[model samples]
Target: MTRLSHSKHNSLDEKDYIETLSQKRNTSKSRKVLEVKSAALAAAKQHGLNPWSKDSLILYMCCFTSFLCSCANGYDSSVMTAINIMPFYQTRFTSGVVGSTTGIIFSVYTIGGLTSPWIAGPITDRFGRRRGMLIGAIVICIGSAVISSSNTKGQFISGRFILGFGVSILTCAAPSYIVEVSPPQWRGRMTGLYNCGYFGGSIPAAAITLGTQKIKSDLSWRLPLIFQCVPAFVVICIVWFMPESPRWLLANKHDEEAHAFITRYHGGGDPSHPVVELEWHDFKEGIATDGADKRWYDYSELYKTTSSRWRFLMVVFMSIFGQFSGNGLGYFNTQIYAAVGYSNYKQFVLNLCSSIVSCIGALCGVAVADRLPRRTVLIAGTFASAVFLAINGALSARWASMPSDAKNLSVGQGAVAAYFLFNIVYSFAYTPLQAVYPVECLQTNARAKGMAMYGVIVNVFGFINQFAGPIALKNIQYNYVFIFVGWDCIETIIWYFFAVETMGKTLEELDEVFTSSYPPRAQIRKVVAIKDDGHVDLVKEA
Candidate 1:
């Protein structure tokens, strides 16, 4: 293991950096901070370290353990969707999975999610990211066991609550670990891929349920519940061997370990690599020893500064918008298909097909995540989703009223097609960004707590969505779709006005953008670096 050297030149650089920050703090007027080329990206390019390189591959494998957190979450969602459609499950449960009873069953999971953030934030910050993940995985396995063997409504709901609690912990810790460990050059795609793992779990769960729906007994639903633990178990087995976040190590005073991890994984075993040096400087500057993460109870740092508040606002926005967008309908997609006159067999098949389409859409999002501007994707994709949702609602309103024998096959098929299209667009837009954007907006000191806050807001809205979706669908029928249609339009406007571009900048570099008088404008400023003197100038364009 190699250690970073504190030479005189580096000392002078640190002094200059601190003084610059102090000056920025004292000044009331806005000024342009020097924005250099991303040193990590430049270093990787200079060293010719491709994605397939030994070091890069190893880093990706380590990151894969975190991806399982998302997989577990995805499996739970898709499996529940399948279970809701199963006649056996409906028969076994006391309430029979309809109306208000259905709402409670779905909402209990998010209710458990609401309880996790208090402990999740502290655990991830205090015990380290790997520990948080491991604990969550173990809890998920326990929850799965409880749910699979459940004999009554209370037992089933308790199991779901436990599952939600465990998933929340993983959600809080895993993204923070991925963003901190990933090199800036690959950060977008890597973190995007983290959420993309949702489809990895969804595909299997959907497929399994499709096959299991043929079973004549309780095992049809119980078997799917049991399978939910597989990804969590995989995470438990492998997470211990993965490297700790370098940012976390440095913040915790494990400086040598931080350096060695960065060297071996990010710098390709070259301690003196520019990526390592730059990363060390940035992590030191960005992470505070006495920041909110170090304190067990103080959350003030998340809202203390204008930048911090802006970051919090973005986190809140993504959390609410991500859940409220008609994707919540996914959990009850079987109900939606039934409303449009699809048979039970057809509903399960469509559910499976929808999961496959969503998986493909998520992969497409991953491919373009690094290439496209974040703001562009959010606005356009959201609007497109709203359009498709409106079409689905219109079709359902027309065709859902007729008797099953009198239903128009073409109109019913169109409604299903529109619903599928809506999922594809939603997956393409929000799926990749949901995990990536929130973490990118947050500073390292506030990351764990902010993400915990994110978990709270997500579950809060998710609870509403899960609890109300069935009731609304039952009473208002197709009218439930317009609520999301209207909200999604509002979401598009919010993203247009407030969303800051994070493309092509290092996490430390984002500090400048967020702290500026107007972050959206600051994000649009073109930064040009002078190779001769290693100085950079920000040219205002937008």
Candidate 2:
């Protein structure tokens, strides 16, 4: 990674890289989750989902099932955001006059998210993507029902933990399922569409609670808890008919099913299609197994080889940098507005508008994620965010140094605008793209485990920011932006050295990039492969 120190951003070269590749390469498409999980949650399931349809409805529906599962994730993530605001929610049921047990109520979800991956990895890998999603949806459904029906604080807390557990498991399987099933050309937009649902769940969760805030029964908050199951069960029913991931089927030795899936979906019902045959050959050559012990705990394999090790660390670091990039601040930006001398009304408007902007960014990502190189989106996103934070910090610092009379001055307005723009840019790039890079970078065999690790790392960072963001806000005031600015710049450096372009390649073709020793910047479109019926070898691009 030290290679980053010598890295240079030659703008002309990047412009050429984007242009030449656009002209030369076959086109393709490309988050795992929301602000936290949105980018990951949208997609479908049913037995070959919509098998009777002559169009690609089956594939789209199957992926859409995953998106439905994400609604559970989004709902759960935002449920508390609204619940905490409702006086009825805070004053009811528990022995303390409320489930004011903060640790048990709040941290329990994070605990479930942190640990579920260990179980999720093997389940998704061994049983199949669809099966794993079913299990997650069922767990979340039960959790939602339990939560809505709970008569005591402990029961609600237990239910929260259970729902969190299920959401974590789906996060691992859903993104992997979407990637495995999607075609190379339209992958980005489809995945980005799922992210839209992530925000979709959240906005409604808040709205539903706010709408019922004055309702005098337990129904006020309980119904929202129960409603979380709507999307979860929707996914479960749909996924029942959807086809399992073609990649998972191939890796698990269901070669016939794998072959047929590509024929039906990727090639429009033609088994002899060139795309179908080439993809199979790529899978065959790329996944040559070493016959190692296939235990569930065999994740040590993630770091056993040099390329796998670098890629694993790369994914982990990206998660870390993203968290440190001050997304939590966006999540809790009302405090930011308060600190900057904005009224509560103004804060509410900004938050509402930012939500709309986030949706816009998700749509943009869908449009260009497939068109632009992955590395370009990542570096540009991080740098732009860092720049925004720096400007925000400057404004806040200026306001802080001025007399109290100057507190609500125009500098406060500038800080608000800068941060809002930051929110918009993040959704377009960092938030949605997070899911694409990891699944694309890893090989098929390790993808489930890799995604599981992705969850753990994200939660670990979330835990830190969860604790740190508030502390920085209270004690250090506006200067806290400097931490993220420095942190994001370092992250940009790491990405510059590690990000290889995965655009336009099949999941199998991505193997050609990571397995090579090429420096990061030159990895794409340079050391190309020519597979003559499963003999995979690289030749320099002429």
Per-candidate Cα lDDT values, in order, are 0.83, 0.68
- Candidate 1, superposed: residue stretches over 4 Å from native: 1-40, 401-405, 524-542
lDDT of 1 at 142: 97
lDDT of 2 by residue, 1-542 (tens): 00000012223343453343333334221101112101011111101224456557776786678777667655664566555445567677432211224434655675677889888989998888999899998998888888899888888878878887888799889888888888666677666666567667776775666566567877878888878888888887778788888888877777788888877887667554445544665665555343211468788657878778866876786667656687766545556777788774555455556666766776687678777878888888888889998999999888888899646578988998888788778778865677677777777788889888888887777655554555555578788789889888887887888777777666665554667776374444433222222111222232
Which residue pairs show backbone clashes in model 1? none
- Could you tally the backbone clashes for each prediction? 0, 41
**Cα error of candidate 1 at position 400, Å:** 2.9
TM-score for each model: 0.91, 0.81
TM-score (C-alpha, index-matched) for candidate 1: 0.91
lDDT comparing candidate 1 with the true structure: 0.83
